[model samples]
Target chain A: MKQYLEIAKILKNTHIVGPYWKLKLSVSELAHRASSGQFVMLKVDSDQGPLLRRPFSIHQVKGKTVELLYEVRGKATEILAKMKAGQRLSLLGPLGTGFSLCDLSYVPLLVAGGIGVAPLVFLAQNLRNRKGLAILGAQKKERILCEKEFKATGFRVKISTNDGSRGFYGRVTELLEELLAKDTLLRKKAFLYACGPRPMLKQTIMLSKKYNIPGQVSLETHMACGIGACCGCVVQTLTGYKRVCKEGPVFAIKELTEEGLAE
Target chain B: MTPNLSVVIGTLKLKNPLLVSSGTFGYAQEFVDFLDLNILGGIVTKTITLFPRQGNRPPRTCETPAGLLNSIGLENPGIKVFIQEKLPYFQKLKVPLIVSIAAQDEISEFVELAEKLDKERLVAAIELNISCPNVRHCTKKSNVKLIAQDAKATALVVKAVKKVTTKPIITKLSPNVTDITEIALAAEEAGSDGVSLVNTITAMAVDVEKRRPKLAMVIGGLSGPAIRPIAVRMVWETYKKVRIPIIGMGGIMDADSALEFILAGASAISVGTANFINPNVCSEILRGICGYMIRHRITSLERLRGAIMC
Candidate 1:
C-alpha cells in the first residue's frame, strides 16, 4: 500500500525503441515497495479541469523513481504529454495487488501487448538472475514499444508485428508457443505474467490455462478514488466482487472466473 | 508566519478546517499512503447502517460536465463489521474520526447504531447521514420540511448517543431542501452540536441513445464542481439562520473553492467529489489556504471565516 506521492521531477521523455506511440514518464519516486503489476493514478490537471485522475500500471521503477508507460489516448494522456519538468503531480499509487512471482523458482516468461509491455519490463529487472524471456507484440513493427529496454536487461527478447514487418508476423503468443515447442525445458519451470489490453489478457489467460502454465494478468477498470472507497473499479471474482484497486490490478489465472473477462 | 490553521466545529478544535466527506474518504486507513491524516481536521467515514448494504448496482457512478453522479446507496460493512474490522484502524489514525451513520426502515436502527458507536472513545464525533438522496424512499419523504423533521428526530437519537459519550454530534444536511436553513435550524434545535451542509443534490442522467435513465438506480446524487455555487449559497443561508457551527462542502476541489465555503459562513469545510478528480485536493487546499493567508497578511484564519461581503 504505497501512499500518494508528489512527483519530484519529469526525467527523460524519450519514445520507446520501436516507432510505437507509447511514451514513458520517468517520475522521481522510489516505488521499490511497488511490485511488478501495481499502478499509480496521476492527476492530469492541477486546476481540477479534469474531474478524475488517470490510473496507469507501473511499467518500470528505478532508484528513487517509477516509470509510467502509456499511449496517447483521449484528452488525459495528451495533457500528460504536455507536462514539463518541476511541475508537481499528486500521484496515488502502488495500488492493487501487483504480479506475484516471488514463489516461482525457475525462469519466468513475461508477455505484453502494445502498451501492455510496461509492467513486464520492471518484472524482468526485478528478477535477480535476469532469468526470464520477454515477448512483446504490437499492431505493426513501428508500434512496438520498449524493445531496447528489455534487450539491455540481458533477457531473451522476441518481437511480433501484425503486419509482418518485424521478427515474427504474428502475435506475441505465437512466439511463446514457438519457443515452447522448441525448448521443452522452457515450459517446465517457467511461470508466466502478462499485462496488456483486455482482449489480449483474455486470450493469454485462456492460452495459459490450456497449456496448464501458472500465470497472472493485470486487470483494468475505471478507478475513481483508487483507494478502496467508492467501489467504482470493481471486478467480479470467484469469491465475490473485489476492488481492482484494492484486490488487484493483477490476479492469478485461476482466481478470476471465465465470466469475469470481457469477452 | 501564519497563526494556525485551526478552527472550531462545535466544541472540537481541529488542527485544520479541511476534512474529507463521507463516502469519498472511506475509512481513514485507506488514505495512509498519500495523505497526512494528522494534518486533516477529521475524516468522515463512508455511511454505515445497521446492516451491511451492498449499495446500488453499478454503473454506480458517472462523470458529469464538472461533477459526478453516484448512486452508491451508502454501501458499507455494517456497524458490527465496522466495529470489529474498521474501528481499530481509525483508532490508529492521527486525526479525529467522525463516523457517518445511516439506516433504513425504522428510526430506532439509527439510535441503535449511534448507541453502538457511543461506547467507543476513539471517535471524536458522529456525522449523521440522513440526507442520502440516491435511493428512492431513502428518507421518510422527499419533502425538504419532512427531511428537516427527520433530521430533528435523528438528532434526538444523536443527543441520546451523546449522553453515553461526550463526542460532538454533527448532522449532515441534504441539498434537495426548499430551504436548507430550515433543516439546519431544525438540527440545531434538536441539539445537534454543529452541522455540515450539501450532501449531494438529487439528480438523474440520460441515456440518450436508449432514451431512458442512465443509472440503474434511475437517479443518483450529483456532486463535484457543478454544485459548488449551490452549496455555497445554501451554506451561506444556513450559517445566517443557524447558531451552531457549519461545515460547508460541495465540489470543493481546490483551496480557492474551499475558501468560498469558509467565506460563505462555514466554520470548516469538507472535500467530497473533488477527491475523485485529484487525489491530493485536500492537502493542496490546505497548502493553498496557508499560502493565501501568508500572501494576504491575514494574521488569523478565523477572521477570514464567513467573511463573505455580499
Candidate 2:
C-alpha cells in the first residue's frame, strides 16, 4: 500500500533483445518497497503525445535502483525507448499484488512469454535462496530474456522459441507440460507462477487446474490510474470485475476464466 | 499575497478551488498512500448507483492524443454499500467529501440515493451525475442517451434529488449536446445550488490495423487536454446563462488550465484526467495556483472568480 511518486532518474536503458529494453531508475523510495511480482506506473514523457502513465512490472530492485523490462509496442514505449541516461521520468510504484512466497519448501516454477519475464525475473531473484526454474518463451530466439540473470540467481533456466531456434520447439506451456510430466518430484512440490500473453496465461491456468498445482498470474491491460480509483484496468473474476491495480496486477490462477469474463 | 483560495459551492466551502473530479479519484482512500488527502480542495467520490455495477467489458480505456477515452459505465458499489462500506472511510480523510450519484432511468432512484446518503453526517454535498455517456439503458425510455442532454430531464432529476436531500445539490452536465447552457439554466431554475460544468465529451478511437474500436463500449467519454477548450467554452456559456456557481472540470491539469476555468467564470475547478498522469498532481496544481496568486497580488478567490475581462 506504500506507493511513491518520484522523479526517478534513469541510470541506464539498454536494449536486451527484439522490441525489448531494460530500464533502470534510481528511485530508492519506490525501488526498496517493490516486492517480487508488483509493478509500477511509469510516465515516459511529459505532457505531449501520451496522456496516461503506462504500467510496467518491477523487473528488479537492486539497492536504490528499480529495473523495468518493456516492449516498444505503443506511443509511450516508443518515446521511452529513445530517452537517455540522466533524464528523469515520473514513477508510481511498488504497486499491486505481488507473488506469494509463503511456501518455504515448494520449488518455484516460473513461466513467462516474450517480455512477460520482467516480473518473474524479479520473482526469481527474490527466490534465489530456494531451488527454482525459469521458463521463458519468445516468438523467436532473438526475443528471449533473463537466462543469465536467472542462472546467476541459482535457478534453472529454460527457453522456447516459436521457430525452434532454442530450448524447446513449441510454446512455454508445452515445455511446462514436458517438465511437469517427466519429473514426479517437481510435479508434487512445484508451485507454478506465470506472466505473459493472455492466451498463454489461460493455458497456464488450465495446466494448473489439470495438474492440481496452485499458482498465480499477473494481469495487464490499459489503465489510466495505476491505483484502484479509475476502475478502468479490471478483469472479470468469479467475484465480479476486480481492478488489476488494487486487487492485483497479479491474481490467483483460480480467478481467471478461459476467455474474456462474460460481461 | 497567497490569495485566499477558498471557494464555496452551495454550503460547501472548499479550502481551495482545486477539487479532484469524480471517477478520476476513486473513493479518495486509494490515494492515501501517494499524497496527503488534505492537499485537495475537495474529493468527489465516483458516481454511485442504486446497485453495484460491473461496468463495461474489458478494454475499458484507451489513450488518444492528448486525451483519454473511458467507458467505465459508472462502475461503483451501490449507494447502500457506499453508505456502509465507503462512507465511513471518508469521515477520517479531513477533505470535504462530495458524493456523486447516478440513477439508471428513474427520478425516484436518484431521490432514493439522495435520501439514503442525506442521513450520513460525513457527506458534504451531493453531485447528481446526469452526464455520463457510456450508459444506455438508463436514458432509453426518454429517447435521450444521457440525462444531462435534455434540459427538462436534467431539471426534473436535480429537483427531485434536491427535495430528498438537505445537502447542496450540484448537477453534473455533459458537453456532448449542442448547447450546454440550456441544461445548466434548467438545473439552476429547478433548485440546484451549483452546477459542475462539462463532464467528459463523447468521443471514440479505433484500431485501424485490427479494424476494431479502441474501447469495449465502442464509444466512450473523452476527458483530457483535447476537450479543455470545449469544457471551458461550456463553462463560459453556462456562466453567462445561470446565476448559480459553476464547478468547472474537463481537463484542468495544472494551475494555468485550472485558472482558465476560473477566469471563464467558474467558482471552482476539478482536476480530472491529469491525476492519472501524476498522483501528486493535485498538490502540484495547488502549489502552482498559490504561486500564480502571489505574483498577481490577489487576496481572495472572489477577486479571481469570473474576473476575466471579455
Candidate 3:
C-alpha cells in the first residue's frame, strides 16, 4: 500500500547479456521502498501505441537508484531499448507482494532462468543468509546472466545452458535435481526460490514436492492496472483465480493449480 | 483563470467532471497513493455482484495495438462482503462514491444488489453494469444477449433497480450493440438518471505462432484509444436521443479526448485505461481541462457541452 507514482529519469540503459537490457532510473522515492520480487510499471514516454504501461521486476537498487532488467520483447521493450539517459519515464512502483526473507535456519537458494534473473539479483543481495546458492540458466553462455552480480553477493553461483555453452548443460531444473538428489542435507534443509519460464517454474514445483522442500515462484502475465483493480494478470489456484498484480507476482509453489501455467 | 468544471448527473453533483472509471481505479483505495481522491468528481468502485465470483480463467487480458483486451468477468466480493469490508474506505474519501454492480441476467439479482447499496450513506449512485461482454454469456438462451444489448431488457433492469433504490441510477451501455442510442433512450425512458457509455467493445486476438487465442476467454472487451472515436460517435448519438446526462468514456487519455466527449454531449467524463498507464492521470487530465477552459474563456462546462461544430 505504500506505493508512489513518480517520473523517473533513465540514468543508464545498457546491454549486459543476450537480449538483456539494464535500465537504471533516478527516482529515489520509487527505489526507497522497492523490495525484491516487487515490480514497477514503466510507461513509454512517447504517446506511442501499446498504450498500457509495461511491468518490470525490480532488478537491483544501489543508493537512490533502481535498476530494471528487461528482455527486449515485443513492441514495448523494443521502444524501451532505444531510450537514452536523461529521458524521463513515468513509473508506478514498488508495487505488489515481494519475496519474504525468513527462516535463516533453512539453506537459501535463488533459482533464475533467462531474464527471470531480474528480480533475483536484488533478492540475492538482500537475503540475510550467507552460503546461499544462486542457480542461473539461459539458452547459451552468451545468454546467461547475473553470474558475476550473484557471485559478488557472496552466494555460490551455478550455471546451466540449453546449448551447453555454460557451466552445466541441460535445464537449470536438471542441475537443481542433481544438486538436491546427491545431498540429503541439501534436500531436507534447502528452500528453493525461483522465477523463470513457466515450464521451468512448473518443474521447480514438481521438484519441491519430490524433495518435500518449500519454494516460491514469481509469475508474469499480461497486466493492465498493475494494482489489484483491473483483475487482469490472474492465475488459477486451489482457492480460485488470484491476480498476479495484487495477490502476487510471487506465490507459493503449493497454492497453484497443476495446470495453472497453461493459460 | 479557473473555469467552472463542476458537473452533475441526476441529483448527484460533482466538484469536477473527472471520475476514475470503475475496474481501472480499484475502489479508489489502490490509487489513493498516487493522487488525492478528493480531486476526482467521483470514484466508481469495481463492479460488484450479488454473489462472489471467481471470475474467468487465467490469461484474462492481452495487449493489442493502441488498446487492451480484458476478460475479467467481474471478479469481486458479493454485495454483502463488499459493504462489510470495502465500503468503509469510501467514508474517508471526499468524492462522491458511485458503486458499479453486475449480476446474472435475473432482474431480481440486479434489484437486490442495488437495494443493498442504497442503504449505505456513502453510495452516491449505482452504475448498472449490464453491458459487460461476460453478461452476454450469462443468459440461458443460445442466442446470447447482454441486458444492455436489448432495449426492453435494459429498460426492465433499470426500472426495477430504480424502483428499489432512491439513489440515482446510471445505466452503463455496451458498444457491441447495433445502435447504442436505442438502449440509451430505453434507459432514459425507464427512469435512469443518466447513461454511461460505451463499454469495452467485443474483441479478440490470436497468438499466431502458438495458434491460440491470447485471452483464456478467447473473446474479451476491447478498451483504450482504439475505441475512442466510436465512443464519441455513440455519445453524440445518445445525447441526441436521451434527455438524461451522458457519462462518456472509451480511451479517454487526456483533456483533449475528455473535451471531445463533452463537446459530443457527455455531461461528464470518466478516465479508464489511461489510469492504468498513469496513476495520476485524473489529476493531470483535470488540470488539462481547467487549462483549456481558461484559454477558451469558456466560463462554464455547459457552454462546451455538446458544442461540437459538426
Candidate 4:
C-alpha cells in the first residue's frame, strides 16, 4: 500500500549503529508498509530550496517509526542539519523495488562502505540464523559503528579503513577477496550483496566475478521521485536504461555495464 | 453542487485547473503509471522542435535559495519523430495533452512544426514558446513587440496548422516583458484559441568557486515557487485584457495556491516546478481540491474561477 507521511518527529543522532545517525520519524502509514530495499523522498521546504527531494533507502521500520541515514554534503543537506525535532517535513514513500530474499537459501556475504552501511544494518538484523558475513569499511576505526550488534546477531564482521587507522589498512574489497580465497566452503555457496561508493562497488563486482560468485549491488542516483515515474534516476544496465528507483536499485552483478558501475 | 474547482479554456472543460508544466513533466507516459493521469486537467510535454536536441550537459539543475536553474535546452526527438515515435503513448493517458514548441531564429520554424503535427489528432493543442530569449537571436527578434510578437507568430502558426488540423492553439508568454497584457491582447488579436502564461523567467546562478555561471548555457530559466507571485500578477493582468482564454501557471503547489490563480482570472492552471520536489504533487493537489469542495459545500469547480476578493 502507498502512503504519504508527515514527518512527526525528526529525531537526530539516535545512534543506531556507530557514528551514523538514525533519523527516526513518526510515519506509521509508510513505516508499516515499507520492505527491505524500498526508499523514501524527503522534502526540506515548501518552496524549491532543495528543488528535489532526497531519496533515502529505508534502514529500519518498526510500528509507526521509520528511519533513514545520510551524510551531510551540499546546501540541501545543510538545511536538514538545522531542522528541529518537532518540525514537520513532507515525505513520500515506500517506493522503488526493494530487495527480494523470497526463496533463496545460501549464506549471504554483505559488503558495505562508509555511509553505504546504512541499508545493510536492518537486513543483518532481519536475518537471524542465516549464516551471514558482513564486511564493513570506513576511513578510520572511530567512524565504524555497530560491530558489537552484528556480532551479537551472528554475522562475522570484517572491518577495513583507508587511513590505516583501524582493522585492515586497505579497502574492504581486499578483505572480501581474502575471505573467498581462505574459505572454499563459504566461497562455493555464498550469495554476495553490496552497497557503497561507486568505486568500491565496482571493485566488489570484479572480485565477486573473479571468484565465480553471484552478486547484487544497490545503486544510488539523483532522483526526483523514489518510484519509477520520474526517469530522473536512470542507470544504464546490460539490458537497457532502467530506473534505479523501480527496476531494482539492487541489480545482479552480471546485469551491470562499465557505464552503470562508473556512474 | 456549490461549484468550486473546474474551469474552462475556450471550449475545453477541465475537471480542475492544475496541470504539470512543460519540461518538468517530461512526457505524461513517464509518470502515468505512478499517477492517475486522468486526475489532472492536462500535461504540457517538454518543448519540441523541428529537430532533436541533446540538451545541455549536467549539472543541468542546481538548487538556489528558493528555486532551481535548468538549462535542458529542449531535449526532444523533433516533431516528425515525436508524431511518429512518441504520440501513440498519449493514447493511454486520460487527460488532454498540450505540445510545447520552441525555435531559436525564425517564425517559420514554429510554422513548420505546427503544420507537421496539425494533421494528426493525437495532441489536443499547441503551446508556442517565444519567452526563451537566451538561445541567440531569438531575444532580439521576439522582444520587438513583446507579447504581440508571440501572438502574431502564434496566430500565423495556428492559422497555418488549422488549415490542416483543427486542434486548439495556445501561445505561452514569457514573464520578462514590461507589460504582459500587451502580449496577451496581441495573442487574442492574432486568433489564438487560448494563452498559457507565464513561462520561466530568465535568470542566472553563480558557482562560488569559479565565480562563473552555474549552468552550461550561462543563463537558465528560473522556476519553482520563487516565481509564483509574479506569475499570478501577469495572469491577472492578462485576464483583464484578453478576450480568448488563459492557462495560468508558474508555482502552484496546493489547492489553495491553485485557487489563487483561478481567482486572479486564470481559466485553468499548470503545476510547473512543484513536481520536481514532490512526484505526487499533481495527485495531492487534485485530492486537496476535492476535500476543499466537500468542506465548503461546493460542487462544480467553475464557480471558484475568478472568485478572489479584491
Each prediction's whole-model lDDT (CA):
0.76, 0.87, 0.88, 0.73
lDDT of 1 at B179: 77
lDDT by residue (tens digit), candidate 3, A83-186: 99999988889999988874778778889999999999888888744678999988999888888888888889999999998788999999999999898998
In order of listing, the candidates' clash counts read 6, 1, 0, 9
lDDT of 4 by residue, B1-310 (tens): 4345666665566666777888777777655545677888887888888887655544445556566666656666788788887888888766778888877556667777777777667677777776654354245555653333454654655455545546677778888777888777767776778888888778888878888777656777787778889999998888878778788888787877887787788878888777766666788887777788788776776666667778
lDDT value, candidate 3, whole model: 0.88
- Ten contiguous residues with the weakest lDDT in model 4 chain B: B145-154
Using lDDT as the measure, the top candidate is 3
Model 1 TM-score is 0.83
- Among incorrect, acceptable, medium and high, the docking class of model 1 is acceptable
Q: Which candidate has the highest TM-score of all? A: 3
Interface RMSD of 1: 2.2
Q: Best to worst by lDDT, what's the order? A: 3, 2, 1, 4
Better of 1 and 3 by DockQ: 3
Candidate 3 or 4, higher DockQ?
3
Over 4 Å off, model 2: A261-263
Per-candidate TM-scores read: 0.83, 0.97, 0.97, 0.76
> Model 4, A66: alpha-carbon shift in Å?
2.3
Fraction of native A-B contacts kept, per candidate: 0.57, 0.88, 0.94, 0.24
Which is superior by TM-score, 1 or 4? 1
Residue-wise C-alpha lDDT for candidate 1, range A1-263, written one tens digit per residue = 45556654565545554432333444544465778788888777746456787788888776667778777766677677666656556666677788776565767788888888877887777764655788888888778777788777777788888889988888877777787767778777768888777777777777777777888888876667777778766666776666788888888887776567642
**Candidate 4 CA-lDDT value:** 0.73
